[model samples]
Target: MRFRMALYPLLGDLKTICLTLAYLYGLTVYDASYLALGKLLSGDVYTADGKSSKRRRGAK
Candidate 1:
């Protein structure tokens, strides 16, 4: 399987985003931003094991 930079169009500035997400989540910025952007655009993300998303009780 391959992953594309699909979040770029949705979120313009990636370099800054990487740093921001990394700092917030204590993850490698690029990797954290990639996953963050995916979740923002798609509402969920798929990993090797399964899928995950922000669990909001009243949002959905």
Candidate 2:
């Protein structure tokens, strides 16, 4: 009976750790995906139409 009491708390702690790990993993994946999407959205691309007027670093 005494051992069972000790085991209960250990099991609860293990469960909590597992849950926290999963949440952090999900958060990291979301952060990575967000960065990828931002990069894709903010990239400079020229279209077939004559609408791009990009400027260089050193030019009049």
Candidate with best lDDT:
1
Index of the highest-TM-score prediction = 1
Cα deviation at 16, candidate 2, in Å, is 0.4
RMSD of each: 6.5, 21.7
Off by over 4 Å in 2: 1-10, 27-60
> Can you tell me which runs of candidate 1 are displaced by over 4 Å?
1-12, 36-44, 49-60
Candidate 2 total steric clashes: 0
Assess every candidate by TM-score: 0.41, 0.25
Report, for every candidate in turn, its global Cα lDDT versus the true structure. 0.49, 0.33
Candidate 2 TM-score, C-alpha based: 0.25
